[model samples]
Target: MAIPKSAERSEVGAHQGSGEIRLVDVTKKFGGSYAVQNINLTIPHGSYCCLLGPSGCGKTTILRMIAGHETPSSGEIFIGDQMMIGKRPVERGTAMMFQSYALFPHLTVLDNVAFYLKMRGVGKEERRQKAEEMLQRVQLDHLKDRMPGQLSGGQQQRVALARSLITNPKVLLLEEPLSALDEFLRLKMRGELKSLQNELGITFVHVTHTQPEAIALADMVVVMDTGRIDQADTANVIFDRPKTPYVARFMGGQNVLTGTVESLSGGLARLRNADGATFEAATGALEAKAGSPMSIAVRRDRIKLRKRLADQVLSAVNEISGIVDSTEYQGSYIKVTVDLGGGVFVVNVSDSEYFVDAVVRGDLVTASWTTADVHTLSKVDMGAIDDPYLDATQ
Candidate 1:
């Protein structure tokens, strides 16, 4: 199959910078339990790769191993051409920005940023000049003299950022760097961090549990589960064409309908659900013989809702009947919960016409989606896909 031009461009972007990092069969074991297991992944140079998983999924351990703060029990870590195994955190050309800004309360912003340069034994005047430039880069130069206590959460975050970048490390490791800020600041800083990475042309490996943050900042997303990489792909592929049941549910926003593949041909599959409801889906890469059981996922937003008695022309598509059990009025969308015997599905309507009052409890509604929007899963249920609180470390 011919690759699309956009896909080719994305591939090129993923390979930029020549500052490649590889984790070869890396594992960190603690007291007979594996925190990270046989994990092998290649992060392209200059790519913004996010290690995304729930707490204790070993993302932080992987970051620490790369930073030389923690050593891998079994595999090797390579940065560009350097082996980082026995090096100290400072020896490896890497910098870490933690969730806490960790700025000094007594030092001004300039002094905080210049502190690193001073440790390298640079002249005081040159170090201050470089610190001032970094402050300007983060748009915090105007607050240079203000102590850490005088700066807001967002401002202090910028100071930490400037401090880390002052030394021009080869790889910037950010471990929930924005997790400490408020919602508004976190959102704003996501953009700022992305811009900074692009401008510096440096390899950035950020670890976070927030799916939205990973989707917004990463050029490549590494989804980890049970101490191994479940899938590593661009944000679009990881979210849209997830390769596993764990990934489908972990990414959220999708309804996984398990069924048997009754027939397959011409890029389409006929699926019969456990509850005996049959649906059609476009199977692009999935291969299954007739009578084989599989699961299909469709995002709630992709499933269109129709009032049972409305006269609007119904488009020809797969459909399911359910009764509204609950409704929530979200400012931009109305979330209607429909109980479909075997499971419940939540669908969102962006049009204000379908307000919370549009479908009251016990109102029968039909949810529909085209074959192209349905995603096929080989073996998994909604329970495995939607349970974000599952112990990923195990």
Candidate 2:
């Protein structure tokens, strides 16, 4: 895709610099309650960062602060080298694409995209030409004359993206931009957003509550909780080795287990749950003692499940005997939920392997995983145990 001339021209501006963002000890309070507390983050220049969490976790609040829509109660925000606390949105060199699109219903797509340039006193013909170039960049030039109400959801989304890009922003803040689209459109637009960010080479800070969306699109995924950040890392690291139980549960592909340490030997800790179920996990560098609480996580796909013999005893380590609570066919894999007495554990079996000897609900099953698959989790206050925004179907 050709770079927009406006973006090229804006590169010469004195404020233009590498689009790195820094939030130092930022906090926001609303009537004695904290919305975000002590948030310190640095998004690298030209990276796609996602602030991921459930509703009211302060992801959007952070985005608004970055866009200059909301001021931090304390601390400082910087884009490149410029302080953003008291600057206007334009002065911050940022543009926001709202969740609702927020396009003018009465304006044509061209006029809507050109609105930013118009506000800056650009001539009508010049702004129209620049807007047309941006529309073509987003592949919506043909729809330039159409009203916002006349466009489809996906088309309207492109228009909004075009409008944001037309500003030639150093950082683009997206507040659930795909939340309104249907599943199909959301998937399609995800690729477009990534590609556009790459072509533009600008920092993209997206706020979302969906785990898959964050994992799929982000170079760095910052998992937020109630007024605090829980984890921030690459998608692979966040998924494969979550730092805390809250993140493991929120990411939805790991089963978290809690037990008391029975013994520590050879860099491995043997733990026993209240039910006397034995589990083993790598101690790594963490200090462990007898009778101390320990938490471990195992990926759902790493578990092996098989029918249990009537008299067969389960293993003392890395194994659990449970009854199948439910099974969901997910095309490539089958999601099996097993009731492990006081708790439920989820296992993902390939469809081919699952069909060989499929176990239905109510079946007696023993699920086991290798010790290498177990990951020690930090003992922290698990935030928002139940996320109302989590999509059950996802």
Candidate 3:
């Protein structure tokens, strides 16, 4: 059967306040293995949250359970004051915008947007007026008479958004909402989604596997690994101070370096690589035992490349010698990949800086950063943390 065109409707004032989502010890299991394991999260009322991970990392599973499409194997979900596990999705005060726009090909945009009200036994004139207001809100009123086949990808998406919002849901759930659009349309609609969410003053829980989409759209980003959350925090915290190696790597823009701790002195933990090149990072209050494996993340733009400083005295802290692996000329910045024996570092250089002293492949260079710039990362299970999106090509 085609997926249900409409969800059950709820009273408007019944869910007036911000839609706060609370998941308590939530788990979803398929057979003997868990698809989503013991997830406990609180999405603030009216906040924009993104569940970001690779395909099969359980982001969608969590979203489905929250939407009441699938019941959790264990634990409870609360949207506003209502327990959602046994309740119908509409009863939970949420409307989901599915990955596929799922618009009816035979219906005009007006009829499609009003289908939910129609199912609720609303008068034709009243529903049409309501749907018209929604279409105008999404800036698609001009296409109201067009069939789904007649509208563009962006237009169809607007129609979908209107249909979902017409329910007046307190929490709007989106599952891979932008995956259907082309690159240009996806970007344009991304901004619109955020703007709409703000204008409505409602919660938006978006599920996506794309990294940039999560970081750019979410006020709160929950980075997940296979069946587990690697990190969940505000966008700045998740991106700037990643809690684990997987987050640092998955979020992109940072280099993950692994080495054995050689010594600890003056609040700095010294780590040595395979070729004996060592670097120092601030240990803060965290315990660092000698010979234990430790990892650190340095932002791509934080690193500086130099021609070895051949004549000057040797360096202080956070410096490594490496051969230039390759250089990519990005419009605003150049990405220089350096091979440091056992690891690779990507240094992002401004366009002006790149043209001044462009280093090519095989050039001996020293990549240096600061102690304060380094962020320590907890060890992650390599088998679980490996990116499926990247693995597909390999």
lDDT of the candidates, in the order given: 0.79, 0.88, 0.83
Local lDDT at 144 for model 2: 93
lDDT of candidate 1 at residue 371, scale 0 to 100: 82
lDDT string, candidate 3, 1-394, tens digits: 0112243333422466559999999999999999999999999999999999888999999999999999899999998777878998777889898888889999999999998889888899989988887787776778899999998877888899889888888899999999989999889889888887777678999999888888889999999989999899998898888888778877877777777899999989999765666778888767889988888888888988887645554455677777889898879999888887665678898998888888999888888888789888776224324445632210
Estimated TM-score per prediction?
A: 0.86, 0.95, 0.91
By summed lDDT, the worst window of 10 consecutive residues in model 1 runs over 7-16
Query: If the candidates were sorted by their TM-score against the true structure, best first, what order would they fall in?
Result: 2, 3, 1
List residue ranges in candidate 1 displaced over 4 A: 1-17, 265-267, 282-284, 309-317, 352-357, 385-394
Residues 1-394, candidate 1, lDDT per residue (tens digit)? 1122332111111222356789999989988999999999999888999999888899999998988888899999988877779987656778888778788777888999998878878788988887887787777889998889998888888889888877667788998988888898888889888987887678899999988889898999999986889999999988887777677777766776777788988988888876667889777776777887777778877878866764444334377777899878778777788998867777877757585348788888888888878887755554654463631211
Superior candidate under TM-score, 2 versus 3? 2
Candidate number with the higher lDDT (1 or 2): 2
The candidate with the higher TM-score, 1 or 3, is: 3
lDDT of 2 at 21: 98
Among these predictions, the greatest TM-score belongs to: 2
Model 1, position 134, has a per-residue lDDT of 72
Candidate 3 lDDT: 0.83
Model 2: number of backbone collisions: 0
Error of 1 at 173 (Å): 1.1
Off by over 4 Å in 2: 1-15, 380-393
